[model samples]
Target: MNKQELIDAVAASTGESKASTGEGEGEALDAILEAVTSAVTRGEAVQLIAFGSFSTGACSERTGRNPSTGETITIPAAKTVKFTAGNSFKDAVNAA
Candidate 1:
């Protein structure tokens, strides 16, 4: 689901209006999202023990082939966000 759908679901489960659910900096969901984004952007890890973890990782420059013309290209190194689901999350998904 998208952000709005997630916000709706969280708000409903918490018995709060979507707007009120996200107070202070904005909405609760938006605030959480922003916090995670900022943390990842700064190369920090955000771990929600039983849920999962988000962290930044680096990719080394590599050679790759263009799909269309089969031309070789250089893939530049870049930072990336990685997520590893926690045991509970993995179990939940597997059970389904």
Candidate 2:
């Protein structure tokens, strides 16, 4: 679901007002994003129990073909983000 839907669901479940739920959710998401960016910038990992982990990794420079031109070019190495699903989440999905 999108942000509004999420806010509505949260408000409904918690008996909170939509504005308050939205504000809290937004602040929480912003904090999470900020923390992840900060950690990744430092080449570190962020883990959330029963959800997943976010980590930084490096990509090796490689040659790749351009689909339109069929010409090969170098792709520079860069940092990458990774997410690994938690067992609980995997199990829930599988059960579904």
Q: Evaluated with TM-score, which candidate comes out highest?
A: 1
**What is residue 13's positional error in candidate 2, in angstroms?**
3.2
TM-score of each: 0.90, 0.79
> Could you give candidate 2's per-residue lDDT for residues 42-84 as a string of tens digits?
9888888998888988899999999999999999999899899
Cand. 2 Cα-lDDT: 0.82
Per-residue lDDT of candidate 1, residues 1-96 (tens digit): 977787788888989988866644567777788899999998889999989999999999999999999999999999888999999999999999
Error (Å) of candidate 2 at residue 39 is 2.1
Against the true structure, candidate 1 has what lDDT? 0.88
**Candidate 1 residue-pair clash tally:** 2
What candidate 2 gets wrong by more than 4 Å, as runs, is 24-26
